[model samples]
Target: MRVTTFAAFRHRNYRLFFVGQLISMMGTWMQQTAIGWLIYQLTGSKLLLGTVQAIGGLPTFFLSTVGGAVADRFPKRAVLVLTQSVMMLAAFALGVLVSTGQIRVWQVAALTAMRGAVMAFDMPVRQAFVVDMVGRDDLMDAVGLNSSLVSGARIVGPAVAGLVMGRFGTAPCFYANAASFLAVIGGLVAMRLTPSPRMVSPESVLRHAVGGFVEVRRNPRVLGLMAILLTVGIFGWSYSVLLPVFARDVLGIAEQRYGLLLAANGVGALLGSLVIASLGDYPHWERLVTGGVFLFGVCLVLFSWTTRFHLALLFLALAGLGMISFHSTANTVIQTSVPDAVRGRVMGVWAMVFVGTHPLGSLLAGILAEHFGASLTVSMSASICVLVAVGVSLARKKGNGALRPNVTGSAGTAGQES
Candidate 1:
């Protein structure tokens, strides 16, 4: 049997979507990098940074399930277009505020919250939209490529942000992000997506939303995976929220150098995504998830302790590699294992755990950084992730088959991807 990395690209619609994502994600990263730096530079309050970040994510936590329900009920392309348009306007507004010297921390936080709310709906719909584009035969490969696209953007966005912020100002990054959305909108408009099979319920929206929870309850594998994602998303992946602190106070680096640190992480993440793509539907996704989680935690631990800038870069890169591998495998497993009727709902739950947990982690990290210092706060968080991995591994050893997905779904299965 042979496995192909670019299998999903056989579909023209997916190809267009992928290209659009490649452009938009870079701009998103640019805005993220600029915003973090701008906040830290203005206030130098770790807790405030965390607070703003948390505020943004709060909507995703509560509304993602509803967003999933909307995806299941409506056309994903339309949902995506609406969400993306709103996000673009938000980004442009932020840029205007910053450029006019009218931007306040409260304003930034408010806009961030608005963006997060839009993402709450957009993420699940976009995630479900992938299946509509390529079906199940190439899901894993497409997922890998998608991860690669994100990391590839990470590599470019931060670099550009650093340069632009260092020379002109943070406003430019925001403006660039706003303009980038046009590309995504164009791609979406150009797509000729076949209508996906819809899940209909003659019940209240609340009842329909609750059904997503019930689906996860019935699947032990998905339950365990979501638990893992929550742990990692909060304690593990939130290390990024602290990177600005790490670069400024700890490593004593300039904004450009800080961007380099981010780019280095992207370099490793890109490699990780490519490696997953090359694996070509490997069977033991559990091992990949566990190993990646453990490695990510360990790398963060090392990164926090390391005083040298170069060494810290290496650790961050390794952390990125581990993070992407863990997430991509987990995403593919969830998408392929669940029934088509509930795929959007489950993905919404997945997005909730994956992204919604970040606010709590950011808040915790910010508070800890203020009291204990950024280095120690990050170190403690990483340690918690390591413990979570160990606990889950031990629990699974005792006869729970939750580590592996069953791969029985209406659209297709993970096993079929191979």
Candidate 2:
């Protein structure tokens, strides 16, 4: 519940990057909200909405590994700059199209696909670059604190987008998002993070990409973590994409109210992330992730059954708390578990699962909502998530001591007795 995790800010580069990232995140959220609202208005089809989300994830699913390769081969700073520029352009393009009345469902989906492709490279580089600013020792604190700012954006972006889109339509929101990129770009340009050498090397790019997969394949704990995250991403995270429908159709809420509802989730998420930031390293973080995932599913099931808006909001707060706690912990574990050299690729692989599957979930949920109902989609996804959590627990029990993983080549591998 602490507002700022300033202890991690002792590192000069981290402090600088944090401020810029905070600003950039707000714009990212703004664009996302505006895009969703626009898509809903234009197509009025939940299936298209789902397809837009699915298209955006295309790059993450396909290019993320190569994006990691790109992060590995090039200077992360340069890569970030390029990706951020691409994002800015894409946002601007969407805004122009909407403003000019040239936008259509296919256009939105195509643009979203372009942005997702850009994100495939952008996310892994950014996630990997955090360690460069803060180092591994304080990496968990840095990651936790970073989530606070992102959730903060979740707090502000939607509300702002809702108002802006209401007053000026979605175009201004898109323009604002495009313009927000300059903040991160400026922050990255100003940073003097020293370039570090690669931990693992191969003669060719394909070989290097394959090498990262091989290294990860050797580690069962990382696999376990990835599996858990995959479950959370596919199920626990689909609610947001479905929210517009809930706001418009189910909840009988207005445009700005959608933003307020999201802000409520952000409030819970921010609180949870700050709590993690305030903590020391959690040895039991694995169980925390698992428990959060399970709690998220439980909350979602109940939330789906609700007809009262205020009651649904209360359940959403609980779901948000579980979601952020799970995400912050999973990110910390992955960053800490992987070695530095292949960390970006490993993180990219993680993003591939965490972000890549979101579209599929959203698409299915939207289709279900269109045909069946939101409640059923929410309930079904949550039920599947519970099953996924159980499977994850069983996998962990089987792997413990039998096949531990240690990327650090240090003592006390995961699943081993200390």
Candidate 3:
């Protein structure tokens, strides 16, 4: 039977989740664009830009494992509702502060940290919840579609935010984001889901969290993927922290045009996600993962060197494409390979390496940008990413059999548990 690119949409629960999340994520990207612009406008400091982004990642770096443990012990939907509500409140608070002209850097940093703490829980549960919604047969398609949803938001959110910010100021962007949460919260409440079996254990939460690490250690392919994510997370992903600097200083663009630059990246990412969704059943996962990363790194390098606005946008779009391609494939592979019992915990580790490492990368990027300038800093980081991708590809060719999908861990029965 031929699988459709939109197979996941056939499931009612996933459809609701997708539509709701699409709305919420657009709000999220709007807030993100506003925050970055706000910080840059206030401080005019590249290091602070990186520092603020790093502040947000610190909580996720430290607490995502514990959050994963919570996911295993409780219902994911309830947890999501709670996290979404908290995030809504945070956005509301930010909106109030900005609207009142009382917003300060410290306040923004604190709220960013708050949201990050909530994400530490939300991300792992949400990722593991995909299989619960669509079952194993459509897991890969679901993952790809989710990526497309996020990328789609990235496309619309920033463009809309730019127009709003240009006309009304950043406060409205925050308010709009605050209101967007209602769609997702409502969807979560409306879903008809079976109760996820709680992993009752005599172990402490720390021990349960550690179990995820143990599982990754036992699986070589998962371990290798984690390592690759670490490199990409730290060096490759951190490049975004410099986008504001790049836009204003290098590309000589204004606030509105900067949003367009981000939208360009989103367009590429959206296309990439659609490609992945269409090829959900493809066998050669390794090639897609490595090739995507190499393409991203190369485009990022070229992007950093470009002074022309259109040229920079072109490179940014290609980089975005490569990024989503690598991320969506790797995520699907890892989720499908792990046992359902430990999926949340394993995803916690994934969050730790992927999301947690962002701060370190941001700090590094900020420092380098402060000293060497944004263009050179980005070029250097992109070079490291390119080199890492090449190294991983070479190692795989040298008989690293563990990188292939494991038959024993196949999603058939392993994904169906509770």
Candidate 4:
């Protein structure tokens, strides 16, 4: 797109942060690709694959709100640095266990859950930290570019991990992921930014955290978006856990080809993110988010019915486009609309809605896949997403209204503090 499409890169701190995050996210995706294959390869159980994913989501469900409160109470940079370091250690541990031939299904599950716990804290802080770096004006661009970076990583990580795991095995993927954290650590260290002014509350921690809940409840737009997000997270995202099954059992593709399937999805997501970036702080974010959800459901349904590998890849790519469009828009809208006072805690609830429900979906998907077959399970999930989108549309017609009319104009130039 235009150079203006990447205006967020004009800010030095955001540029540095973006580069570091890109590297780290690539590693994270590689680890995810390898882990899914490893779990399935070891257990040969679709249920267990879903179970591992469920385990990963469980901590986020339980602790993400508290994690958001922690983000508000503490320095986000310090929190992120600490969390990133712990995640690095966890990755190394997984590598060691896998490389030693000592890795078991249970160990993988436990480690996945542990990383999820760290992410419960890390996701909100990291997301909230974006505004601190770019401020309000470039917030939309920053969000879009960040998502593009993630989608870019998704492309590189899975394709490379597929080859890497196929050749050197899964351990190297974990080790590589562990080493990649250094980039993020370095970025955080190098950045120069003043601390953000918190809407510091006089209330107790519990009361302060609870106040975030109240803030969201008072905003109909945020409340409705959160409801839609929860539904999407629960039904729309669990296709990830089923990919290995889809590749092996449904499409009859080899393990090496699995990465290609995942990469195809990434390519679509990258395209969608770039389009969002090009839009550059557009006012009609609700349209983008809702439309994306509708397209995602349609693509997923198409993907479910496809037995041909090439066709499946095309459908998966379309689904990825829709998925990222919905997600990035929702993220930018909430971040820009909320007051900085409770941003962290509010984002914590956002994290809970966006990710917390995945555990439930993963568990349900697993059970459904075991009995109903992968194609039908995925098709059913896709149907739910379509229904959710339609439901949202109807609800909006009944006067739920747009997200924060005040946020409708161009972003203010004042950069948010650290």
Write candidate 2's Cα lDDT for 360-385 as tens digits.
77777778878888778888889888
lDDT of each: 0.86, 0.77, 0.88, 0.85
Estimate the lDDT of model 2: 0.77
* Cα lDDT, model 4, residue 131: 72
TM-score, cand. 4 vs. native: 0.95
> Could you estimate the TM-score for every candidate?
0.96, 0.91, 0.97, 0.95
Q: Per-residue lDDT tens digits of candidate 1, residues 1-418? A: 3458789898888898999999999999999999999889889999998989999999999999989888788877888899999999999999999999999999999999999999999998888888778777777788899999999999999998998898999999999999999999999899865554555679776668777889988987888889889888788856789899998888898889888889889988999999998887576777788888888899999999887999998998998999898999899888877888788888889889999989999999899998999889889899888888777777766864556644445663221110
Which candidate, 2 or 4, has the higher lDDT?
4
Worst lDDT run of 10 residues, candidate 1, spans: 409-418
Clashes of each: 0, 0, 0, 3
Which residue pairs collide in model 2, if any? Answer: none
> Which candidate gets the maximum lDDT versus the true structure?
3
RMSD to true structure for each model, in Å: 2.7, 4.8, 1.8, 2.3
